[model samples]
Target: MKLLLTAISGLLMGLTTAPFSASYLAWIALIPLWLFTISHKTTSLTPGVKNKLKIRNIIVNEKTLIAFIWGFAYHGFSLFWITGIHPMTWMGVPWLFSLLIAIFCWLFITIWGAILVTLWSVIFRLFIGSKEIGNSPLPPLTKGGEEQGMGIKKKTWLNNNLFQSISRVVFGVAVWCLLELLWNQGDLWWTSLSYTQSPNNLTILQLTKLSGYSTVTAAIVAINGIFAESIFVLGVNKKQFSLLILTGTLGIILLHLGGFYLYKQPLINDLSKEINVGIIQGNIPNTIKLYASGWRKAIEGYTNGYEKLSNQKVDLIITPETALPFDVEYIIKNSSFYSAILKQKVPVILGAFGSEKRSYTNSLFMMTETGNILSRFDKVKLVPLGEYIPFEDILGKIINRLSPLDSRLIAGTSDQIFETPFGQAITGICYESAFSEHFRRQANAGGQFILTASNNAHYSEIMPAQHHAQDVIRAIETDRWMARATNTGYSAIVNPKGDTLWISEMNTYQLHQGTIYPRNSQTLYVKWGDWLTIILTILSGILWIIDN
Candidate 1:
């Protein structure tokens, strides 16, 4: 019954976080869902038909079940979003194969690591001696009746249930928020090191480095997990509880809805002109490149679509990353193709390759109406294993044996704001959209509008569309209008406040046209950029030390 309950809780948690843009409740949904696992742990003891029961057995079972459920929840829910990705889209394959691949990806994610750390930490705290609980090579308690250890001292200790419960709730929330924010910052680092099919390059060292960072990141997450679990079990109905939920919900909502309102307010709407930008949604299949006959058809599809939209005379014609697979130089040299850009009149921003020496970059180029390459920004953050392989010499044979044609591409430096005839725009290509720092930098570096191009088709409808929401968040964070162009769908014109002024549907070939404002300024997040997260992380660390 207990195991069944634990598993059911796992399934519920999984379902809740699976769909993209499901609800803000998903973030805190784990709180109540995890309670079932906690409940099973406390009831596992057969108390000889009575007697307040053996607390020891309860603690032990709690530790074991807690560990199992933590792993199950993190891997199950956080990675549940993976099914929406293309790599795992081969649903026709053997069930075991699909399951194994999804599990493999989740196991490596930093969130899963944090779950493990939290469960173990809790177990150690409950049953282990004070010295062991502190996990430091020092005395457990001092003359002051406070626990003391290496770089740690207990300022607060609970002898009663109420105090412990209150402490637990506060600890849990602080931990979750701290870990969430830290994970936010660490995501760029992790993506830089890990392998993905989209960016297409990562070496053995880079993969190994991902594991290393994931371990450290998980440890921090685990610390936060302890707080989360404690609160789930005992921290309900407190004054702080309402505040936690309110703040958390508001943060999540603002993340999705706030982008539009903040950007379109008196600053952008009343002052700036709503420029119509045309986004060409080129729905190119992943397998198109493999067939010789598909090349002409694919090229024609994009070119024809662009030609159709060109007639509209929009302010900017934007397309997804690698809308044209070839290098930018090749496109410019071709008079026929260059004319396509020039005839549009307004500046054109699209994803393409930029070659320098032996290295080829995943880049975005801003072209003038007269066929001039106004400015170009190379993608600094490359997806590991997808774009390029890391540690090729050593892990080459192994990686090749597992995943063939796995290679590495060179990364670009400098997040350059393209100065065009219309205005200067902050542009992020593909995976660059996920990193908040990149957008903040571009905005701070005198970018008037945020222009992002992405090829999310590799993840199919779920991830790409959900991931595209990052643009909305980016717009809100920087208080700038975000114009997003995705290869398949979810293209949108987002205001500085993080609201979607206009958005394209998912999984289709369409040319989305909308007039978007250029904010020409900055927000608190844009200026300071993750300073709040840093302060929270530092405070959490300080609290952890003090608690120990």
Candidate 2:
């Protein structure tokens, strides 16, 4: 029964994120898990046997297992679209083997992501010690010096101290954000708690300018903790229960009010300039892109989109990742694609392969109107197993069969900016958008706008929408306009306010033109990346020490 409740809680939490977009569910998603922890901690044991057995350690292990189950369910449901990579016959794998590989990848990543939540639960149980002091019965006083009820004297350890209650909420929220921060620095990161409110909870998302998405994440976790506390105190302490309800209510009201004020503030200044940008979505399939026989079709799809957008005389044209599907030297020497780009009057920012010595890189290139190479930014965060295999020395023989790429691409330096004709811009190739700090550094380095190029053709429909939501969060965090161009669908233009001004359909060849402004101002998040998270982590440690 406890495991069932934990799984349900995890599923509800997953629904709060994109493709599901049930943001309201986040407020109560943690209640069941908290209740389980409370009940497990307060369970009665044989009076004499409790001390003989290692009950504390046993209960801690049980709580950790429950938390792991919850996390597994949450990530598995949220990232179910990972199985869309199956049917690798397009890349020359057997049907059964391709299906098995896709399933294995899904389970491996789900378990990897679940580790953070498991650690969070363990630390929370250790520090918070879910004893529910408010609900415990108070001993009766007698005329004698000692109390009569339990043979203990009256002491100051009263029920439902406001300070203790507030500390628990704060510590829980801090631990959650700190774990998210640490996990994001690693190789795999998909959805953060902040994304649960994205594109829908616009007012709440505006707070991200103060600190990164951790602000929103804190808000979510804090509210859930308050409600969980209220549930635990119901019918036990009326004053504390009422106070908890009022605190949760007032917190929500004030958060939205403050967020609205921030959202209404002007983002553009007199020096802000607008550039007419054209985004191209070439719906090229993986089968055609990998084989030599279909290179012409791939070339035609992108080149035709380029010519069409250039005819509109936009200031700049952008293409999806690997739009050319060939290295720079090969294109310049053997293909007409380079000549086609040279003939265009407008400058083009296109995605293609870059070669350095014998190493290849997935890179974005900015070209001058006269067809000269202006600047290049290689992809920094490569997708695990998709872009390159990890632990190749140990697992290379077996895992290399799962990758679709012919060769591994090298990672570029972090925080690199591209100097464009309009202004300096930052680029996050496909998977890089998931890391907020990656873009925060470039924004701090004087990047006025963002350009993210992606190829979403490999996954199902759900992945593109989730990818789009991540870009929305990035735009709000850095206070910059974003131009997202993708190979299959959901290419969009997002403003600093997290609004999707324009979007395209999936599996379609489309051309979209929108005006994006380049601003000189920076948000607090851009200036001090993850500073709030660091402070919260320190505070949490201090609180743990004090509580212990």
Candidate 3:
């Protein structure tokens, strides 16, 4: 029964976090789960029926054990989306090997949960001490709150927990800030660094400059979470807790909606009609995409999508990054149909592969209705293993033979915004969306909207999508509307304030259309970048020192 209750509660909690009206209520529901341990106590049986009482105690113990089981089960289910990619990744492997990998993932997740609980235990203890502003009542270790019942140093234990929680939060924030500082270096954008191998490789590390602001942003988020924890522990009444959680979540969600709403209302001036945008999803296998033949299938899938949208009246069409498979310059310059589609006068923005004989770049191209190239935006950041391996030459000889993946896809040298008739659009390909500074630079540089082209088919839709939703915080960071087009799921629109206006189902091919406001402008995140995170980290550090 306890297990059942825990499972049901967990499922409810997960469902409430979905993109729905009830999501704001998850914090309220979470409290009961946390509070359960507070009241957990064993009961003594009557002397008249000692044996019967033993049976009753056994039942209670069973119930308690089941409850713990249910809690873990619920946690696993709530996080099942994290595991979705394992099955997909294991498709071509031998059955036994795939099974082992799948089991390993589940095992890792279970261990992760154990670690999270241990961390929460420490943090929860800290929250208790600071909850009511000073020394307060805590659960007695034994019956009747008797001093002789448990003689261990209670204050010492409590203080230790508080110290550990504060230390973890402080350390986590500091590490994040340092990483951000390292990535951005001196310039907010367009900072260059020398490479070990290619002195003339002249690599342009703009994503960290443009999008590397996440380190600071994440620190600010941690501060807010800490504040929320304080409120949960110290707030006067249940109503206060409910209202605070509700208000905070609602305010953030509204903030997201308001940005897009405000942008569209003013820029369009009531004249903007809803535009149909077709997104193409090519479910290409990650393992095969590195090989020579990978490009052909990817191109074939995109060409079919292009032809399907050709006869339609789409004002704009989008394709995931590198959806073009083979080099775009080769096909667009040589292929007849590629030129013919653009002649129809509908502008298209599609992910393509491009090279200048000396170097290759993962890029997005903008074409006029007549299929002529108007502009191009190369991906600023490269995926670590999927795109190219770092320190390849030394490691490549060993890794190349062991793993049949490519190690030579190179990075780009610029953060150029695409000039579209609607306005200037900035591209954050894949992981670029996680970095706030990159989007800030784009907005500061007169970008109208953020268009993120991603290929999430490699991972399951849950984590990637949830990870993608974290970008709403980025939209909140920059106050610029964003539209994400992903291959194999989660193509959606986000308002400038950070609300997901609409999103598609995972692992399915679909086209979604929506109205977005585009304007050359800036927001708090654009101007200040990661000052909030720095400030919060400093504050947390100061408090930790004082508390210790």
Model 2 C-alpha lDDT per residue in residues 1-548, reported as the tens digit of each score? 88888998899989988878998898778777666654424444445655435346634567778888888888888898998888788888889888887898899889987787787776676556634434454455566644543353323334334555666777888888998998899989987888888778889999999999899989888888887877766776677789899999898889999999988987664344678899999888877776775578778877787788888888899999998888877877777667777787679887999986677899999988887788999999988877777887865676654545456788998857799999899789999988999989889988989999999787988899889989999999998999999999889999999989999999998999998988777888888787887888788778656655
Report lDDT (Cα) of residue 49, candidate 3. 58
TM-score, candidate 1, is: 0.68
Cα error of candidate 2 at position 316, Å: 0.5
Top TM-score hit: 2
Question: How do all the candidates rank in terms of TM-score, highest first?
Answer: 2, 1, 3
Candidate 2: C-alpha RMSD to true structure equals 3.3
Q: Please give the distance, in angstroms, between residue 436's alpha carbon in candidate 2 and its true position after superposition.
A: 0.1
Provide backbone clash counts, one per model.
Answer: 36, 0, 12
Off by over 4 Å in 1: 1-20, 32-72, 75-107, 110-273, 289-292, 401-407, 538-548
lDDT tens string, model 3, 1-548?
54466566655544533232144333343333333322222233446756555554544444344434434554455455544434333335565554454554455454444333334333333322222322133445767667654555565544643454344445444543444455544211110110100111111111112223343234233443433434544533343345445655664455435433543443222236344566666667665665556666766666666667756776677888776655786777765448557556668787877774566777888887777788888776664433654457864553342223222456665567787667788678876664555667777888877778887776654555544554555555565667778777678787654456787777675666666667545555576665644775576667656665
Best by lDDT: 2
RMSD for each of the candidates:
10.7, 3.3, 12.8
Judged by whole-model lDDT over C-alpha atoms, candidate 3 comes out at 0.53
In candidate 1 the C-alpha lDDT for residue 23 amounts to: 29
449 Cα displacement, candidate 1 (Å): 1.9
lDDT of 1 by residue, 1-548 (tens): 65555455444434432233332223443443334333312343343644234445444544465546644664555454544432433323345554564554555453544454355435333422122111112225455534344225332222222243333433443444444445445423222111111111111111111122222222222332343444542343343334444544554445334323432346436345667788888777654522444345546766676677778767778878777777687677763546666665656776777787776787888877776788887887775434654556764443332221222356777645677666778888777765767777777888778888887665645556445545555565566677888877778777654456776777678887777666655555566654543554465456445555
TM-scores for the candidates: 0.68, 0.93, 0.58
